[model samples]
Target: MSTRRYPHSSVSPEEFHKWLSTLICVLNSVYFVLNMITLQKLGLGTMQLAVATFAGFCLYKSSNGFYRPWHSYALLISLTINILLSIAVMDLVAGATYWGLALPFWYYSLFGLRKGFIFSAIIVLSAAMVIFFRTDTQVFMPYRTIFNFTLVYCSIWLVCHIYEVQRQKTSEFLHSLALQDDLTNLKNRHALKADFQAFQHSFESMHMLIIDIDHFKNINDKYGHDIGDSVLIKVADALMQSIHTKEIYRLGGEEFVILFKNINDKEAFRQAEKVRKAVELGIFFSHNEPIKLTVSIGISSLRPEHEFTDFLRAADQKLYQAKREGRNRVCA
Candidate 1:
């Protein structure tokens, strides 16, 4: 078993799934043992034991982020096994069919909306078929049993559906908060780092530009912070309009970063110049007076031996050079 910790917190869905898988393994093992000892139903018992062992191994591997490629399919397979077992044991065990009731919750949590609903339907239908066809099972009020089962299963499905919808909304809200800048509505530095780190190994070549506004402090000092904010907003708008790609980040204050994917050094420098010119040409008005704004940009392309920090530092150095040489220009 691998001991490596995956990139998921204790509260994350992956961690929750891991714990759930572990629980399933233990519970299934116990059920299998009990069925084997008392009922001696060799087929059901053996199948349950097999499922238990599979769940256990998958849990171990997935928790440590090892061999996780089959994890999703494993979930579906485990649920199918349990559903079959539940139907098969309905006649032998008292209230065995009730075991299928929890299927909705697990499906929704593990597979998400569409697949969850589908699995839930399959479980419900399988249980119903067993009840309808296997009339040899000793039970009273057959119509009432069918009615109540259908109603209860439908209720469970509806509840799980609503819960998953809300969970998805909350997840999306949190994800946006983590990645988006509150002021400019652009992605923030945290988002930039996360994205770059995840995709750095995959991208063969890329370009980065660090942009800074010229004498931004003077604008804040001369016109007040309100006007300074307006300047930043306008500048952000200009940059957004100039770039065709979504890999733009607001690095706080007056600094912004743009990442160009699969672009060479010459093309990167050309894009930086184009953005600088766009910002210079953009017109902004403050207190009925037109203000001309310009930005200095430093461009750097990924090198064969560059780490993320090295690439960023190269861009920063070039930005400094641009500022020193003269504002309103691009440096490489």
Candidate 2:
């Protein structure tokens, strides 16, 4: 196997984002209480009910699956409508403009730039509409609030864009890591295992061929360790060249396993013979000399009741038989 590292599989980042939603919900509850203290200041009924209802929705989202990015956007829409309806038309024309700034932080961290920006625009425009219609308060309200809101919005937009770009790079890096063989840059045993799973349900009618190079240790001893490494690379190239979308696996040292998904018994036998002949036809030329190479192959049909390991063991036994009988041939 090639020496590249493949990270083990794990849960997706989206699956772990629920805690963020819950934290936001708790914050909403706190904000709701503070807003309620302004009840006599604003009036008794409408604005207070509107804020409390939104807090209740946040709590519901926390307890349910509503914390996802799409749901957060939907909740923002609902809150916008509620705000329009509850605030006195004259009071809305005044200077209470905050729901816009607050809602984006709830969802933006979890999404990419285009989507996060769109969501922010939606909330901001919704607030602007209410603020446009509401207060004429000259006390706390000024044209600078619009400028400040826009500044904060642009800052958040840049941060989210950078974050998404980094995440995408990391995902691609992980994908490349998965396909690499840890020792040689060849495909590893894990790749073969994944292809096998693809076939178990869809292509139950297929064959397995397992190949092991003959007298490899003798070469390692005859040549130096560096030469031995070169021989392994040449052998891996030969196998890869001969196989057809067949998964090539380095099972350590001189043993390699190739699996061709969705081929019948006779076709599989033909394919195995082709590989055996291609590998054994000549020597692997490295440096100025030709180093003769031959591989022994064991072929087996996958039966309905046989587990993957069982089939592999059967193929392995045939491989040993080929070595015992004389190498450079295939056996079933």
Candidate 2 lDDT (Cα, 0 to 1) = 0.64
What RMSD does each model have against the real structure?
4.3, 5.7
lDDT (0 to 1) per candidate? 0.79, 0.64
Report the lDDT tens digits of candidate 1 across residue range 149-263.
8889889999998888887777666677778887788888878787677667778888899999998898889888999888888888889898798888899999999999888
lDDT of 2 at 301: 81
Q: In candidate 2, what are the lDDT values of residues 141-233, reduced to their tens digit?
A: 535555676677567656765666675678556665676565567666666666666676777576778888888888888776788888888
- lDDT, model 1: 0.79
Q: Write down the TM-score of every candidate.
A: 0.88, 0.71
For each of the candidates, give the backbone clash count.
0, 19
Where in model 2 is the C-alpha error above 4 Å? 1-15, 36-147
Give the worst 10-residue stretch by lDDT in candidate 2. Answer: 4-13
